[model samples]
Target chain A: GESVGLHLPTLSVQEGDNSIINCAYSNSASDYFIWYKQESGKGPQFIIDIRSNMDKRQGQRVTVLLNKTVKHLSLQIAATQPGDSAVYFCAENRNNDMRFGAGTRLTVKP
Target chain B: GAGVSQTPSNKVTEKGKYVELRCDPISGHTALYWYRQSLGQGPEFLIYFQGTGAADDSGLPNDRFFAVRPEGSVSTLKIQRTERGDSAVYLCASSLNPGGHETQYFGPGTRLLVL
Candidate 1:
């Protein structure tokens, strides 16, 4: 009985604004999590990942926050741009099986 | 360096036919995984290989779906009696694992359509 899902299915943001996508996972034993961005007809590109040992990890223009107590994960994109428009997914890797949340579509408007 | 790659970016076939999807993981990546993504849904795990052996095949939907990694570099997922429901984007991912600390890189994926 394990599932990973996002809180929102779609999000709209203006260029230069910030965007936040949230995910909730049912497995408390999941120790590793990742964020992926998939553009149309492209693969899910690796954005950032956070281990259970760390609460936060940052990358170029992106940040991933993990809250183990609540089994919640969130990805924050700074200065969101048109290029950032895509579907974002959060995944939990446990027991060598990676489980992905449905996804959140982010549209960047001019 | 080249990223993980899948062959035949797209494939269309008739129902009840058979198809093969191939994945070439990044060089030196010890772990490879396969997933299926439907329209508007996240990719679901199908299988994983550790080196030349299949460490996990539990996620495969049924016996008709099979995957293998020989020589531990390339993998092929074979489907028998392919059905319309099997039409989806098949994804492959590779990760350089240093124990639990790892990040998975995905390939473009093969978009399969059953007619």
Candidate 2:
């Protein structure tokens, strides 16, 4: 069985500060990892992804780190803004199927 | 240029009733997926379609859930004898192909409320 889980259910950070959301997966065979941001009344939006062969991938202000050795994944948002407030999820893709974590609600305070 | 679109943005049905949710993927997309998201939870995979056939449906909770992607363009998810537990946001996503590495573009989703 494959399970993806997040360390923090909710996180609050001051605007302009860096935000990091952590995720842990049980399947060591998993290869692909993706990060998504979902706002209220909307579907999950793809942010970035990292493959098992890669340890890190960056896009714009977001970076995804994948540690296959520990089955850990993380999404880092730099200079977070109020609009960045949303529920962030990490999904592990294995065999063309993706398993998502519970999600971490990120709140950026003014 | 339009993203994926879902019909009946919101659906309210009673227990034991049947419900069908529709999803229109982006043009030229060869892979489509269905997911269910409960309150305060991340979206859970329900099914995936490559072209007109179901590539994988292992995520379906039970026999009560079914989906189809005829013509390899549009897909419909059918729920039989819906239960209160069936209430959730039904999300549809599509990628360029069946490749596991492609990014999946999602729709707004259809909110299903089974009373």
Candidate 3:
């Protein structure tokens, strides 16, 4: 896979701290949203997802918050680790159509 | 179970050339998708297939890009008269089904470079 987020904005976080990545979706009709993590040389992997009916969803150490009014979504990673260093993406889906946002680069430092 | 697999992990072609990229989806997965990713950007959806039929292809940039999944498992994305802008990592993903927004498992994409 291509290495993404080379020139995108980056967020640096210390290990053991929490990191938040945000995204603004384009479609108001989008009902399903998903967060993905892509490490260098690997394809995007599913992290967490939320639907318009729900404001929040939690996975192991990750949480997804959806604000439908503003079309905003965010992923919160608690106790971030070096293994979490990667580019994060938010995607919106409606009627089987999914659109991804430009990713945010997360660099976790020890 | 084997994950999605793509062939020719890397490909470099000349402008105006034609190329084909292959994808073998996970066994028994009924939903398949194609996406193109450029540097600094997220993977853009290119096409989606349900069974052996293309369910959606609105994401395809133009007619120059075409895909086929006749057997409902193996897919091939074909590009004609390639341009520099067409160079990117082509990713393939598959899920159990299309509804309910099932998680899509992706393969290490095919890196295409048009010189």
Clashes within 3 Å, all models in order: 0, 0, 0
Candidate 1 Cα outliers beyond 4 Å, as residue runs:
A1-8
Model 3 lDDT per residue over A38-106, tens place: 998888988888889999999999999999899889999999999999999999988778888888899
- DockQ, candidate 2, comes to 0.55
Q: What's the C-alpha lDDT at position A103 in model 2?
A: 85
- Local error of candidate 3 at residue B111 (angstroms): 0.3
Q: TM-score per candidate, in order? A: 0.94, 0.94, 0.95
- The residue pairs found clashing in candidate 3 are none
| Cα lDDT tens digits for candidate 3, B10-113 | 99999999999999999999999999999888898999999999999999999999999998899999999999999999999999898746888899999999
Candidate 2: the clashing residue pairs are none
Give per-residue lDDT, candidate 2, residue A28.
Answer: 92
Query: Model 1 Cα displacement at B80 (Å)?
Result: 0.5
CA lDDT of B99 in candidate 2?
80
Sorted into a CAPRI-style docking class, model 1 comes out as medium
Per-residue error (Å), model 2, residue B75: 0.4
